[model samples]
Target chain A: MGLLVVFGQIYDPAINAAALAFDRALRADLPDGVIETVPTFRSVLVRFDPLEISCPRLEGHLQELLARQDWLQAEPDDAAQHWVLPCVYGGARGPDLGKVADLMGRREDQVVAAHAAVELRVAMLGFSPGLAYLGQLPEAWNLARRSTLTPEVPAGSVLVAVRQTVLPATPIPTGWHAIGQTPFRAFVPAHRRPFLLAPGDRLRFEPVAEPCYAAFDQADFLRKSGG
Target chain B: MSGLEILSIAANATIQDAGRPGFLRYGLSAGGAVDPYALAEGQALLGNAPDDAALEFAGAGGRFLARSDVWLATSGAEMTLTVNGDARPWRQSFGLRAGDELRLGPPQTGVYAYLHVAGGFQTEQVLGSRSTHLRAGLGTVPRPGIVLPFRADLPHSQQPLKLPRPGSFSRRCFRVLPAPQADLFSAETRQRFLAQEFRIGQMRDRMGMRLEVEGSAAFQAETGLSIASDATNLGDVQITGDGTPVVLLVERGSAGGYPRLVTVISADLAALAQVPSGELIRFQEISRDDAVVELRKYRREINTLKDLVQPVFRDPHQISGLSGMNLIGGVIRGDEEDNHDDD
Candidate 1:
């Protein structure tokens, strides 16, 4: 563990922008001894080898980087891409779609429309390989994760909770509502580029019929979809 | 084809190396050997490369049959080694002829043991490494009857190397540095943590080891224990909501929300991994400067492992019924000696 440069207390676009900007700057001109820099929701975790630099020295270096610019107003990376993934909502594909609608006091179709309506930013990627935590869902859609775990959610699962949507690349247990399923895999180790999304990348889901989901070449989904 | 066929193996025994790093951004933890020191030791003994793959046996070893002539080395947790029903030195390298059965027993002192080949195991690499990441499904546990392939072309003219067993398993106290959320716990609670002696719990794996303390007065944080999800590093001591401390390891989740109180330094992680369950342990705080110095020393130690290795000269008098022994079939040829050190 090295040090954290906190940008804000809660999840905000500007705060995350600052964190991502700082992360980008750090990665661009990484200081000596720095092992890795992870950009989370509201902070950038700069893990460094203490053998190369002390914590105090690393902190001071980070402070110098922080003072170079007003990170709060930094623009998102220009290379950040916008993705639209085809998804199958409700029924067997989304076991918790009805549950989420019930909690939101809306019909299942309405819930689907509301969820697919807003584009979210990839605020963080963690917990499991290639699992992206997309953020800033409509305030009306803000919900809590389930009290009980859903034993296991498969890859491409669309999970929603606390104004964030999670897309897991592997089967994992979750507390969030699985409202949709996408064929697009965010993580493919065999691919030339394993990770499909990066921090600050924006994406929105496009509802497709279950049959249409099967038509999207599974093997070529990485190249075919996310257009 | 040179290969080691698995006759039988303990549960969770899998292939490992230095592990895959640089994937934390994609939520992948650097899953690798639990005791990297032992892996390096085996490599030194066998004259293998640093990233050579070896079988990491936890708690117990297993039975393997060589399909062809292959030089092998054993390291990590001390375990009884028997080649074709004859006992051999635990930390010595030896040759196994085709059909020779090499059996390893349960560890006598630590959790993980290693079996290395003269040439690294030629397993397929996933994401630039051959280390098994069970949780992430990168590799699978080797099962019985599976053949593990390796390169055995080079003739090892030098005598098999013999290295003394490391005393890391006996270490009880380890060095630690405060984690990012160390201040979340009150100073009094932190002091109590330093003063307390905990035992390794039965719940242990590549991911982490749980520490069990005496009595009901658990270490509590003055602030909220659950922080926003953030990247977790190796050796991080994460305190769960119920007040239990688990030392995250190589195969740990990339990110977690639990408050981390401290992190064991890299140099001491191998020793910490060797401490058996029920072993009592205490953590002492060390400054970043000191930890860095220790790491440099550790790197130097690993680099000079070849210096510690000595030739295991076979004694003619010690060989029982030398005339009746099938020396040519079992032993390596002496004339093939290539004096060049592979390291």
Candidate 2:
């Protein structure tokens, strides 16, 4: 059995840890019939079959298991995969890159350097198949989404909205500012595991010539953690 | 090989099954039938496997020809179904031989309808699902000149099964379960959400339905939050920046940056899907416990209907043809001379 009433609103840090702990606890402690658990940026949705266990019993079980430990103290997932996505920053490839630089009062190259400097973590995965929501941008990198949405941002485009970098798996109508382009597909039907980025994975962008876009599909994406 | 050769299909028509679940972790929404109840009903009537694929008619019906002997069950919003130019009753199963022509008219009361074959369509599976994820560019879209493959082992029920047809417009209010972000809106906006009647905007599809507050000021979030995109589910009622409410459906994205105010209860999703564009809708809030109980009841009812299968004794076309006559049987059969659709 798990949490009885299965309804709670939470706002807390260590979201990644909580997601990991939640997944572990549900898998390790709970009885069968837990159909699916969708871990989001803030909360985890536990879908269950009432025919197997009543809500009250499930809630009671969940509460007892959760009371044993604080989620924030749980170990974070260590299986983050790294990839070097070749990106062309601050040009037609990124119509919004200059805007982001101007907004931060930094030169275009500095913005690109700062973006490439950090290995961003995938805080969440959603919005589309294989789309990764990466975050923890430095304070100086804070930027808002465009007031008007760009009707279509091509697939593999790097977009910045608020403090997160979103890699859309498909062409999408977006409010986020497109700051770069990549040939490294996060999702491809041709692959066995179509989605590339899982929650908690990490990635860093590598600068490349914009003309490489013509042969971008031939480029290798998965790179070593360092260099 | 048993197959369906599409003669004409509405833009919205597509092949669908229960859909690919467990993929949301990879940022894929469960893209399946918009009106799942309809899908289930068709399956039940034919005693087909639970995961078999069916045709989802999202527009004014579609026309097709049977390439082999096939049995089909119709469910969802009420619509005119005809085989070989004869009117047929909906929510029932009938036999079709090779070369039989079938056509479905636009819905009379709701937006979408479903056609279930005796042996579910054998379309290639992507990630273990026959359902189409239109946004993800997955699965087969039904159109003219396309052939959908299926197995032909199951026998079509001789007696057509009839379940109670839902009244299209009677129920406009749906049950809601407020999500964590419900409190983010101003109290006034929250009240207006349950009290005001919203019209389904033209921009409606499997992904979601944009709702506009009818007549009065459109509901807009007075304040906004820099919320990170998070996992979303079917039935999540999301509020856009402009305050427009979009009700997420089966094809909803795996996650969304917009704040979700509430989610329509699972039991009400079928009703929500049938709600056509421009229709007025209201919401009634309920506790999660109550919602769960209701959902269980709904599932139980559908499962029970599986055993209620019986026969629609006399053939529909046996009558004068136009008289859709069945289930309480009285209307005169349609005149065969009405050749406009006969061709």
Best by DockQ: 1
- DockQ metric for all predictions: 0.67, 0.45
Predicted candidate 1 versus true structure: per-residue lDDT over B76-148, tens digit per residue: 9889889888888877787676888999998888889999987878887889998888878886468898899
TM-score of chain B of 1: 0.93
lDDT of each: 0.85, 0.75
Off by over 4 Å in 1: A53-57, A218-227, B156-158, B321-343
Residue lDDT tens for model 2, A108-225: 8998899988888777677778877777678786676678978888888998866678888888889998889888788877666677777666778998896786677532434342
In terms of lDDT, which candidate is strongest? Answer: 1
Q: Model 2 chain B, poorest ten-residue lDDT window?
A: B325-334
DockQ of 1: 0.67
